[model samples]
Every structure is written in C-alpha cells, then in structure tokens.
Target: MVKQEKVKVKPLPATIIPPTSWVKYFKEWHGLKFPVITCRPLGRLGNLMGEYATMYSLKRHYNVSVVMNSEFKSRIKHIFLNTSLPDIPASAGPFQLQDWTPVQNIGSLYNYAPIELAAAGLLGPKKFIMKEYAFEMQMFHQFREELKKEFTFAPNYTNKVNEFLSNIMKNRSSQLPDPVFVGFHIRRTDYKKFVKNKFGGHLPGTSYFTRALTHYRTKYPDAAVFVVASDDLQYARAELQQYQDVYFSQGFSAGQDMALLSSCNHSIITLGSFGFWTAYLAGGEVVYADVTTKHDYRFSRKSFEKFGLDYFIPLSVD
Candidate 1:
C-alpha cells in the first residue's frame, strides 16, 4: 500500500475588523449590564447637595434612584422640582441582587482600582448603594451644567423669589444707582459648636463680616446691598447693624433662604457645604469665606479645588 503524503494547512491572515460603535462599546464596557445606584441621603438642605450631586455624577454611568422619604421630598421639592431623577419609595426593600455593592464614601467610588475594574467590565456589581454623604465636590463638578438643568426651582418658587428680589431692589433709594445684591450666609447655632470643636479659634469673628462688607463697599463704591441669612438671626442683626443697607432674612424657611441666597450677585459664605453650594449655584462674581477654619475628613482643600472655589477671597478672623 502506498502512504498518502501528509497535507499541511496554513492559517488565514488576521482580519482587521473596525472598532465597535460607542453605544455598543459602552454597553459591553459595563459587562453587558447597566448599573443602578440607590441612595438614601440624610442631612439638612446643604448636606443634601452632596447626595444629589453624587447621584448626578453617577448618572453618567448608571441609572440613579433616590430613596427620598416624605420629609426629604417636602424639604427639597420646591427648590429642586425638576430633579429629573427617578424616585423609589422610601419603604422599598434592599436591592436583592447578588452583585450589589455598597460604596460608603466618595473616595471608594472614585478610587483608581474600582474605576479601572469598572472600565474593564470586571467589577462584579450591577447595583450600588450609596449610604454616606459623598461631599467631595469633585463628584459632580464635571456635570455642573447638567446639574443646573436638573435642579431648577419650580416656577412658582422662582416667580415668588423674583418678586421678593424685585421688592428688595425697589425698597432701595431711587437716587442711588441699582445696588449689587450680596448674599451673606452665617451658619451659626450648631455650626458655632462645630467650629469650636473642629477649628479652635478659627471661627469667623464679627471682624470677618465687617472686613468683607468694607471690601465690597470699596469695590462697588456707589451701592451694595447685603442680604443676611443666618440660623442665629439676632447674631447677624447685632453684628451687622453698624453697616448700612444690610437686610436680615429672618422669617424665611431654609429652602426660601437658599433660593434668596442663590439670587444674589455675590456672596459671603461660612464653613459648611450649605454655604459652599449657595455660592456655587448663584454663580456670583465674588465669594468670600474664612478658609482658615480646618475641615474635617469628609471635606478638604481638594474639595474646594474640585469646584474651582479656591479663588474665594479668604477672610481673616484676626
């Protein structure tokens, strides 16, 4: 019998397929599954910004559902009526998926390892629960314009706020030129004790306000009106009485105060996220703060840097 010669087959040339579309790439990048981020944020109005902003940032990569209790809804609805975020009932059960992950802080969510793993479709979680205040300003800085659209006030609130501002302006002397409206937020009451414990003597003194007031007056020599929003109205009233054209916003609710603050052309803020957000959303020409006060771990210099707020004029309590 004749032996047949062995045949050898050569491999075909490597195919040069084009890259996939962005939509397809995005889907596959996240492991062929879209993520859902559920959050139950707790805090006062200012603290809520950290929560809302974090969710807004996450919206870029996942579906965000905020578990807003009735109290939370009542507090924020007027100011942020068009939140555009989907809501889950406060009583909803835990996300029962085996792949659920809990990110308790902003640092963990933005850490290099997690981000890299997520991009490579290796991160196992399909749903993430954010239980802490992601107060790091960087979380939402990239989506500021988007956040502005999402957090627009309801029309009724906006109209009322506008009328209130108009009345304030109208009350000024007609002989004087239209004065610049400067919002001042003195975060006292609990904040005083907080500052004493956290910042020692770095708490902003009465001199800080007077100095800031004088600075603005010099800068806008013709006219300047300062609207004071303080938890301690009497303190603001007493401290600011020597200055002219200062109005204390004593009777308004917290939401109303925030709206009024955001309407100002400039601001003097204190050492809290609440004050930080008011100045930020207002898009004021100038924002003054006492940066000498040290921040707790939850916030830091990087937080201010992330929001481009390092430029805030630093007032000295001394």
Candidate 2:
C-alpha cells in the first residue's frame, strides 16, 4: 500500500460568493488563487467510487485541483491506480456542515446533467466541498473510461483472481480455450431491509440466480462459466450446488473479491454499491435485480441511460 501522508493543498480562508446566484460585494483577496475542490466520500467502496468519480468529473469540468478526505484516502487509494490526490486536513473544512454548497446528486438522472454545476458547484477558484453516494450516475460518464483507467485494480489482486480462475477452469472436463466468464454477486444481509424500505420488498433469492444463470447459458451456450462471489458464501454454495460449471471464489479479501468479479466478461447484480461497480468495470451485459417498485425512481430507464441494452432483468425472487 502507498503511504497517504503528503498534501499539495494549503488551506485558505473562505472567500465571499462571487458573480451570480446573488453576489455579495467583496474584494478579491489574492491569497486564495487556485480553487481546491475537496471530494468528501462516505460509506464503502461503492460510495467512494461515486464520490471520487464525481470529484474527478468536476476536475475535468472546472479545470482545478481535486483533493480527498484524509479518512478515506487510504482505504480506497489502494483499490485503483489513479487515485492520486492530496488529503484535506480538518482545518480546511468549513466550520459548519451547511457552509458547504448542496450539489444535487443527479448522476442517476441521466437525461439532465447540470452543465453549470460540477460535482461541487460551478464557480471561480475558491475551496469548495462535496458529499456522498454516487457510484451509479450518468454524470460520471465522461470520465468513466478514464475512471476505468484510474480504477483498474492492483496487479496483486488481479493475479490472485486470475490464478483462482485458472485453477477452477482446469478442474472442468470441457476446456473452453476462450471461455466466457460470467460473474455473480450475491448481496444478502443488510440489503433485505434496505431493499424492502428504499426500493421494494422484493429481493433476489435462489430463483433469481438460477434465472440469471439460465439466461446467460442460453446466450453464451457452449462457453458460459459461472463464477460466484458473495458476502454470504455459504448461502450461494448451498443454493447453487446443483448447477454445473459454477464455482465459488474463496479465501480472498473484499478487494480481491471485487477484482475477481470485475475481471469477468459480464455480471449479475442483486442490488448494492459493490455489485453496481463490479458490473460496471466488467463492461458487458449487466443483469441487475429490479429492487424498485413500478413507480420507484431508483428503477427508471432514464436513470440508467448510460448503460448498454438488456442491462436490467426482473426475475421472480420467491
């Protein structure tokens, strides 16, 4: 792991609001010349990607320096190759949380990207702050290919997953020289409630996996190899024991697990930030569980416009 101690930003005093949206009279204090936008990310890997990607997207738009919060700087820096940024000290942050601008998180709302507002806000050079949850938005699209370059997993992780895949392939009687590896992410645990309340009561179960596996089988026909990774390994093993060409990835850390799944030709997600990213990095036909109810905003087609065709498929959870 790389040491995350260095910082390039020198914190400065907050400058008065400039130009429009109601401007206050203020002289230009030349002390704050280059504006620094801080990327304040919360939650786990999924949320961090959104936060950082938003900031990265902002840097592309605003053409300024981007910084990361010290807390998450170390946790996520190792996952990707290009997450090089200065860490912000607490002193640089605003006295009150509300002091920071409220930027709308319409990354999911693909049809309209606020051209005027970067992930932080569109304004002249002055230190600005940002806040959480953005892994699945269209606003992050422009830098996505670049984001992929930035997010490419460490070589150690890739090697580990590759070795595991090789071993699994060797055991199979049929040798597909160019097998289509299909990754499956079974997200259980907290999702039972999160989905019930936020999206709908429906959740992916054994049937959901079987259906997804069946669909992939019909599509790839001869060369579909299923590689299942999950928070609940025992559940996945038990449920999928009857199927052939299916293998479980074990003895790896969470980061390694993500590396294994994202290396596949496609993905099957059961709804969560982790699953969302795995499918995204894999960049193929992504089949996600429809956790949203009929009118739920989370399941809108317009929201997922950035994705390719046949990305979502609703299956019987029971």
TM-score of 1: 0.75
lDDT of each: 0.60, 0.64
Off by over 4 Å in 1: 1-34, 61-75, 89-101, 106-123, 198-201, 293-302
**Candidates' TM-scores?**
0.75, 0.75
Residue 153 lDDT in candidate 1: 74
Model 1, position 265, has a per-residue lDDT of 87
For candidate 2, write residues 93-186 as lDDT tens digits: 5334444444434545322233224322444434556653544354456565787887888888888987998987787666455578998998
Model 2 reaches what TM-score against the true structure? 0.75
Q: Stretches of candidate 2 above 4 Å error?
A: 1-34, 84-125, 174-177, 294-302, 306-318
lDDT of 2 at 17: 24
